[model samples]
Target: MAPKVTYSDLVIIGAGPAGLMAAAWASRLGLNARILDDKVDRVQTGRADGLHVRTLEILDSFGLANAINEKAYQLREICSWVRAARLPLRAGYADCDKNPDPEDDSKIKRTERVRAKEEEHGRFCQLGIHQGFIEQNFIDFLRREGRLNVERNTATKSLQLDEALMSDHAAYPICLRIGRSTVTMNGDTADQGWRSPQEEIIKARYLVGADGGHSWTRDQVGIRLEGGKTKVHFGVVDIVPITDFPDIRISCSIHSTKTGSTMTFPREDRLVRFYVQLAETGSEGDDFDTSKVTPEMITEKASKILSPYKLSYKHCNWWSVYTVGQQCAPSFSKDGRVFLVGDAVHTHSPTMGAGMNVSMQDSYNLVWKLGQVIKGIAKPDILDTYNAERQSVAQTLIEMDREMCDFYEKGAGSDAHNYDEFYERFRTFLSGVGVEYGPNALVVPAREDGSRDSRSCTDLDKSRQTRGFSRRSLASKIPIGQRLPSFLVLNHSEANIVHVHSVLPADGRWRLLVLAGDISKASQMARLRILCERMDAPSSFLRTYTPEGDKVDSVIEVVTIHAAPRHKVELFSLPELLRPFDPKLGYDYWKCFANNNAGEEGDFDDAYAKWGVDKDEGCLIVIRPDQHVSLVCGLQEVEEVEQFFNTILVPQQRRKATAAACE
Candidate 1:
């Protein structure tokens, strides 16, 4: 019989964190998505186990952080250890001169203790949990949502794109032939008779390749990774450590005098992961085989680097050999129909624990754009921003990884002092908080000339001189084209404390945050009322872009944060535009928030002050579905905000007509 055929809005070619995240995004946005992998089962043992602060924030947005926190190990401080005589001792360093072998140059001592997660970043600290658990969380979400199930033991036979159908807005142009096979990660197969293989044809509007560094989809699409490998080779082993190391429980980097460096990550369940640099590979490139490196060699190298202090393991869970390399695909997508995400497009050393975090974030940034385009809520042009935005981030990560690996390899020599400084400088980048998308269809340009120079709010000051408004002063702390920092605020109606991020879930809607200052004041009230009246008008973008039968706030939701005492201002007194009422459901009280600026320094900080918005004259900000601030303008600048959306969102009538015609 001929193979059965099916259709999906998106067909993801991997079931790792990146692919699962894409599937989750599609499910959340109500899109038909199919995800597959060749592996027979999810990762059962060690792989990419570190979760940085920004990653935690992303998980929190999906309501998965609390669960992860309960199971994962919270890594608070990173202790740097080195030979005591080799470097200048600082206040935080612990000198071990009293040791019997203190005169020996090989003996290492603790140099510094750096906090793994900055306090200002968020409530979450860096966490060490196996990659399998993270993938499981996304799988659970998929199952709970009744949206998808990963088709494991599946292999892609062939892929074809109908370039002719690409011009059609509603066409499923990408095609794939896939078959079931009991294939494992080691390229081994089960008995052929155990499960008879069946093939199927799948047509998709969009295709995503999250199939790791050796990506078949990337090759099928004709994209090439453009970089080279370094001479350094490292072996990582996850084991239940048995040691007298003073900082065994702490994450640390130890560089030996004669051997190499060892980076320790204390994981959950009393397990610790050690990344031990084994060799330089030198001129014997072809002869120096990484696959030949064993767990014993890794343990020995780790033991040497952590000299004097006993280091051993009773049981080893997993071990792998890796060569440091940096490479990225020139582009993330092809003809705007097929795309690459995560390790498919970028590869680098995993020493920084960024492989999984950056990979998941890539999907997080791309899928929402795909969701909007697939749902006909946004223009196809918005999809292009994914490549432009994520490519730069991947490139930056690659560079940082290269330097970090270099530090681990040779920093014990001349580069030792610079290591701490280097780490401190890019620590935010490592935590993933510093990622910023440049100007694109999604992120509004800072300059009147349509250029985006920096992701800093200060850059807007130079651009907005013509408007006589200091864009820097309007929202000085909240940088456009970056994720909004979370702060405490109170629900206007309930007077209950809440985190700003708790209110803004990762739903596919553009948030029009009306930072309407003290609304009890006449000037602020009048300005807000005028804006509300304009939004209430039929010609408003909020109305024009939202489908006819849908709720008013369906496409672009208005969430007002007023700088006023909760008891002083009643919820009903605010204009209806801020709290749209549905015929079936009553008024939307959750959309309004009151700035909690009690001077006593309680749970709530002065949000207005933190955001750098004046308590009397406020600003209007547009936050994307991914929670990145896209546009910042004066409250009365309604036309500018509309023009911003006009570039990306499609009018509801046109979208409906297109849908009907396609049907």
Candidate 2:
């Protein structure tokens, strides 16, 4: 029999992006987690190398994206179109100011407009960094937080769920076996010292099979992978090249008649990654040795693909050849204890460059739900939403990958026949114009038209209008479920602008912002104060105008009041504190204010004109930690806010039978 073992709160197999994110998020939630990977060091190359905007925002929350961004090739521009010899048909990076025309009256949905606005914001642009860099950044984050204890060169030989070891009445077990060992350090310290064959059978309360495509943990749990394999083999090579291709960018896909198709992406260390589509026309057996496809072959392939355009590489950094396939597990969880993420749960072709992005997002979705359960803030059933929500995205990605492959890698005849329509659809998709999320998703609220909820939160308040308010438009708000845009906040105390996210609490929770103009208005102040107390929420109260004799220091901050009619004041008072708001700071005023000084310059008198808030009456707004609107109602009825929160956050009541089973 296998040796008995003690237990840990969580054990994650595989140290890839998904596993790393899972561990890091768990740590943030105050859970002790251990991650095991068979590899000794981060993979130098030959994996995903693109990060989506949403992934970057998620990384920002952990304070890790900046480090990676330092090493990343900021893809500020993209040039796309067909070319004869991989030449630029049209090339230019996307500028921060290329906004859609606001006055152009189109019947497009408000969410679509919001997405366009976000794209205009530019802070959420795609980042080009290799998977290794992302992993290293997460590792560094864990180290700085003193939360992650990862074991490299450690592999789990087996895993088993035991019912007896579980909490007596618990449905999910506390039993999981992880067979671990150490590698040899040197020849001298053999046998017992360095290279010992010591085995560790670890039991974990929760197990995650981040072990990748060929996941051993997944097999142990009897989760069947339900997807087919690809017939084509693709070779990835990393090289430092000396080239004069001015338009060559990260998301470039090149096609050639001479040597099939190849794509290149920028990387650090002056390196470029090449994904070459091989001519594996008819290979019946899996015995084909991919090692035969060397740098020389890749060079030849590149030469053929970029026929007229001179391309050459002097130094080869890394290279690997592997078959591409799309596969996914039927479920993300097993017996409510063992879970799978990233490649373990779903694997897709790399054409769309979404694998890493989706994997990171998976962790983001799971982490918050898991935190709520572990903290007893939410029920365990909430975890079910993980599968309900992410599975469809994974499937959608698979289809997208297939379409990308068909359009980019197929023959000339195929391209000529099906290029235009497919290309247009794909381009539209890449602009992030049409992606939608399910209604039950945590990030986005349900739509009024009864469409499924999507994570994209742009243009959510298209209904709100500002006739004369141009300085401070509602457009400044970052779309819901989208990454919070970064901007400079005037920290009057520090006399310097600070990043907005720097002051926010890292712990994921709700935030209630009260923009009160006169906190001493006995009736209104009492109502507002009572509402704040009842919400069990932290608030930042700023006054627009200080009564002639009132002390400004008592409130969070004070600013000049704008002129407004008495009727407008009765309608809504714009907080003078936000009047000097810096558009460059976007929506990060809280962070800037908290970190900087109380005395800063620059009057935002013009900016406050658009909020429709009269300088006379105070206004209260509630923003979720993810920077989405939970409620915007006035502070009069405490029950309204409470009911809204309950409706959106609390689980619905079930019938007696289902409730009993859940209990």
TM-score of each: 0.93, 0.70
For residues 102-206, write the lDDT of model 2, one tens digit per residue.
Answer: 343121101100111223433456666778778887788778788776777676655667766554322335555444444454321112322223456775667
Cα shift from native, residue 578, model 2 (Å)? 14
The alpha-carbon lDDT assigned to residue 192 of candidate 2 equals 30
- List model 1 lDDT by residue over 1-663, tens digit each: 788899998999999999998888888888899999887778888989999888888888888899999999888777777764445434433443221234657678765666655555877788899999998998899899898899887878789999899987589888898888755566533223224338799989999999999999999999999987877888999999889999988998887667778999989899999999887766423335866788988998898888888888889999998877789999899989899999999999989899999999999899999998988888887777888788888888988887788788765444344555766777788787788775555666555424536432322322232232225457888776788888888888777888888877877888999999998887778888999999889998888998898888888888889897777777888898888787788888899998875542447868899899988889998899988988888888888788777777889888778779979
**Clash list (residue pairs), candidate 1:** none
The 10 consecutive residues of candidate 2 with the worst lDDT sum are 107-116
lDDT of 1: 0.81
lDDT of each: 0.81, 0.54
Candidate 1 stretches with Cα past 4 Å from truth are: 91-103, 182-197, 284-287, 412-414, 417-419, 448-470, 599-601, 658-663
